[model samples]
Target: MVARSTCQPRRGFCFFMSAKRPQSGLLAGRAPTVSADAYHWRMRYQRIDLNLLVALDVLLAERNVTRAAERMHITQSAMSGVLARLRDHFGDQLLVPVGRTMQLTPRAESLVEPVRDIVLRVDSALGTQPDFDPATAQRHFVVIASDYVSRVMLAEVVRRVAAMAPGLTFDIRPTSEIMLGELEQGRADFLITPAHLTAADHPQEVLFDDTYKVLACLQHPDLAGGVTVEQYRSLGHVVYQNERGINPWFEQWYANQYGSTRRVEVITHSFTLIPRFIVGTRRITTIQTRLANQFAQSLAVQIFDPPMETPRLTEVLQWHRLRETDAAVQWVREQIVAGSHAMPPI
Candidate 1:
């Protein structure tokens, strides 16, 4: 049987149908799908140049061929050639000129995230080392962690990294609702969070276990003879509030054991600022024991255990499961564990 071209266009491409009568056999009915898939797959590999992906990444970022060329340190004509090839391979005008600037088409917009992800994975694969040499490795590690971890663990971890890996640097970002997205997208290398909050699918290691302590001004009269549930509930409390969602383990536990009637007088995001706000005020807050002790040593604050039984805060260092085999990321996780162990146990 001969094949004839269809008048309709599908995804800017044509479809063909056999002129012969429909086959009664099941094998013949499914043959076209498999054949078409294999044909398109072969054609895709033949037309796609991996180098064009690099150019596409830059083009998406800059939205201009000249700017992309400048960043890639290539001639404008060379960049234009790459773009032309990409447009032909993709069967879409990826970028369209809109007066003074260029705009991404709908298809281009859809390709942005996946293309960036592929380019990032490729870069990471090429850049990863077989054996990380901490003594001389020049790398920057990005960490997303809560304020408590930043104060209690990250400071020591960063200090050790600086001493051992002098050429390396660390960027600590505050914990946010999008932290998991950042980790999955390779925007951040490590994440520090409590075990309850850590996703089970990721590669993670427990850094340390911590207990909570109630922090209050040293001269607060109500807290002189150990705090009880009644006193704690009556006093104003300070808690960290961020878009990352609530992390009120203590409050939740208290509500289960006691009741959900405690007053939250102040809500601030910074852990350091919590102490300043509580000083000379009747407001009290629950913090990790390590951080509370550190603050107690310098600030005029008193630390006490919570009245009811509370769960242990098991802090863990996590990375994307896909990056578990990467030597550099493994080394960073090891350094974090070592740093946590070296510190005095909380």
Candidate 2:
């Protein structure tokens, strides 16, 4: 005789196990027992293919068969076949066409977060090393940071690490509103941004704090002596605006305090470009002191203390919660923090 039981370790997942009864002596008519480890391995290997989960993740993310194929490095037809299998297994049309675009079915939408979590956990478990040797480790890290932070902090961090770990590489991407999502999805290893912008779910540390400064052309007649509050507000301004038209931290503060009293002469998407627009013009811009000083050294711009008190800008370094124990990640984070400490006082 055989005894059968079902196990469910996670929601939406079920496993069945069968054990034969012992036939003799003291153990007769008793069912054999299966260890938890044995049950897990049997369910994983015999019932599911992890590769399919990976494919499903990619498919849901892309939502387009051709693009999913391109991302997975498989043929379009192959991706379609994988989709068919996933649909059969899940008993739902995971991706259905809505006009020309594809949309996730309700079931597929429900699986996105859990599936990503499982994939990241598995990757972390398999990729963790007992120890890390920076000198010989071949590793690549992806960082998301604003251009201002990149220039003032991350540039120095990379330079220092290059000398210590020649085999390590970095891919730095610009900071965006979706940066936290990138970190959660394992697409970014580090995020350097203002403290307020960081996600509460992650672990973060204060990299540095900087004050705001008013920047104007060196030859601007009104600001030659010094800028007064009236002059600061009356002057045309060059400001930073992201692609999504969201204002920077200082801009938001300015709006609340002064409310459109200052005229914006120019709006740019780049933080570093703010000085370029200010130079050779009467326009003025408020920027972080660290970046403003760097620009003042080479450009014909004069830095002044803001006429009105502004909030301090605190830049922070954040990483995924799951990577807290990852040795390589911790090593790189230490290097970055050390670099921040070594920077000249603003």
Residue-by-residue lDDT tens digits, candidate 2, 147-215: 999999899899989999887788899888899998878778889988989989888999999999999
Candidate 1 clashes: the total is: 0
Cα RMSDs, all models: 13.6, 11.3
Model 2: residue 311 alpha-carbon error in angstroms? 0.9
lDDT of 1 by residue, 11-109 (tens): 101111223221110000001122343344435544565567667867887799898766555578877887888899789999999999999999898
For each candidate, the alpha-carbon lDDT, in order, equals 0.70, 0.76
Off by over 4 Å in 2: 1-46
Q: Would you estimate the TM-scores of all the predictions?
A: 0.72, 0.84
Find the candidate with the highest TM-score and give its number.
2
Evaluated with lDDT, which candidate comes out highest? 2
